[model samples]
Target: MGKLGLVKARHLVSRTGMGAEWATIQRYKNLTMNDAVAHTLSYVDYTLPRPPRTSSWTKTVGNRKSVSRQRNMMRMSKNEGAALQTWWANHMLTTKTPFLERMTLFWSNHFPSTIAGTKQPSALYHQNVMLRKNALGNYGNMLMAVSKDPAMLIYLDGYSNIKDDPNENFAREVLELFTMGGTVYYSENDIKNAARAFTGWSIDDRTGKFINRPEQHDTGVKTFMGKRGNFNGDDILKILLQHPRTAETIAEKMWKEFINTSRPNPGYTRKWAHIFRTSNYDIKTLLTAVLTSDVFWHPANMGGLIKSPVELAIGTMRTLPYRLRKNNLAHNLSLMGQSLFAQPSVKGWDGGESWISTQSLMRRSGLMTNLTRGNLRGKHDPLFMRHMPECSDEELMAWLIPVKPLHPLPTQPGRQRLVRALVLDPAYQVS
Candidate 1:
């Protein structure tokens, strides 16, 4: 494990927690771990200024349909669409906690949902709020909220589930994707039984409320994992949580996300899983333990991972010597397959290797060029050079990059010359 001074620590935190920034990272460099952790957590709730609206539909049942119609109309209007883009731009620029914001962004992709598919932006928005506000909170709470989430209800066909005719989509995903690993922990019968338990649990299309229609609920006894019960959705969840695989599977995913590998050490991951379950699914503790470990700060681990497209774009922009307008910034990201509220599918954007291809590489290189050369409108900052006075050219390269130190400046005159010639290099492209 690397025990870094403040300067290096800032770089590590920013890359791992948020995408990238120089000033805030340097500012936090001198602080103790406690202070630094608190400062990092503070940047989470940079909510955009919501426009005011006097909707009479929220007051009574009669106006509800009109309200929904109005919402749909606004969604279709070009002006409102432009404003939405503007809101995201401003939020990204001015948010207090870039670390938390980026973490929320990371989780959003990890558990992908699309307002375009669900036609429920409010539910998508609700899920965003839930994830952002509680990204580091209890995993159990997040799981439960996601289970009944309005966006999730529609995305996974939870709303279509009926008492006698249960939809297995949500239940299967909850087990196979969300909590447990593959079929190792659950059999086909368990999935079928779990599906029955979730019947009658749905969202109200008009109000976005989670409604449990007991009348439509399946009350049949279920034999799940060799145990019998008149299991409902909650019962299914409870049973899943109780399984050892649930804890281990989640620990594995968490390690992959933060530790930068899908194939993390299972023994070590299981140890962390025990820590997570023992602490009652406190995600923060799990994250802290992982981040502060020797495995995390090792030279081999540094920059060994690929940056997701969103990370590449955002990090490059933030590190640029310019000021990008919010609308344009958000627009640029949208074109690069990472629009804020619009993911492609329920599986979300595949990270790591899948995030790159011939088409995506062009988009990535183009974004870097646009940001660096002041090609973007109203976004040219000359102050970027001053952000890292302490970091020399070689140190700057190391600071911005999460990779092992390349040949130091004095050793490789030709490579140093090349680095000076190119504003963006292959190193910056790595994590």
Candidate 2:
């Protein structure tokens, strides 16, 4: 309702963006909550650095077909995938629109296509662009675009689907994961019918784009969701979009994403779903409802969510002057279980408390330790200190730690020392 002061501003920025950036928080601290949310949704940088070099689809497919060249293809994919990961990691660290990147990451996980799965980094690069472009736009449009994305077609075996033999992998995931959220709402017959409807959808071998093979398509009438018609892939997507559970699935996911890890309140999710559906599945509309909702600003919900590896590592770098000793951030992220573009499965990372296993906690602590190792000494780095906001210790504490420090603050007085202690504190792992 009122101005989002330092505390509320940090909560909003840290949760939405990569981290609670000091300059952004400072600017947002002066604006009303509604204005701040609007600014976040409106501001975005679409420019991306030059993409890493990757083999063309034709070359990749040819190499895979040859026994001698298969190993070479694997090597090429491994090398190119690493480069792709670094490119995105670097962008996340330096992007002006971290929230856009965050939403892109969210959708990437939601509709995952992997380097190993596709073995086509070029296709994956284009897929990343598509996801970011529609990250805050229409969910329906994004779903349609992703369904036709070459990387998804290859990764999910949609490219191999034919009328004579319909591979139901894509259809099953669409029903169970993407649109409906689970198997309860749909039947095996529904999945089979959906797969039949999508028979002709495939990637072009030479140009690596979506193409429909009409002769290979199942043109006969198919009964899907109790509606009989001569349906195609687009028709199947339209039917799912019209389903109420599609909106509810996204709304529930938003609850876990922005709100907390606990089971979503159905009442709140239903209300948000209504807003999302009424707005024709506009992502910004759903985000507005989520951000302005009372639950988002509730005192009990503060620090309720654990930071993912990206948030913990890149967020620390963005928030403070700490930098990784090595330039292997992408590798470090993979080690910490949030590898870019390489989700563990179609379900992606389980996130939340699952991020804090004994092994991962050690790695997370090690990362924080290494990043802040330079500031452990009693004295402060003048360069780092100069970059810090000109604020008192209390304000610094509020800005750095979302909740009260779980560990006691260092009694000694240097600002850098205080920062190091707060960052390493257990409380900093959440929010």
Highest TM-score: give the candidate number.
Answer: 2
Q: The CA-based lDDT of model 2 is what?
A: 0.92
The prediction achieving the highest lDDT against the true structure is 2
- Model 2, range 255-296, lDDT digits (tens) per residue? 999999999999899999999999999999999999989999
Tell me the number of clashing residue pairs for each predicted model. 6, 0
TM-scores for all candidates?
0.83, 0.98
Model 1 segments beyond 4 Å from truth? 1-3, 31-46, 51-86, 374-391, 404-423
> Which residue pairs collide, candidate 2?
none
**lDDT values of the candidates?**
0.66, 0.92
Q: How would you encode candidate 1's per-residue C-alpha lDDT over 1-431 as one tens digit per residue?
A: 22346445744665565455666666666665555655565445646567313222123223334766655544543343344545655565566666777767766765666645555444565677778777878778888878887768877888889977888988888888787868777888888888898999876545757888888889989988778989888888877777778888777766666566558788778888888888988877777767666666676666656676556766655654445554577677776767776667655665666666788778776776666663222213224434334456655665566654354433433322333324355566666
- After superposing candidate 2, which stretches have Cα over 4 Å from the reference? 377-380
lDDT score of residue 356 within candidate 2:
96
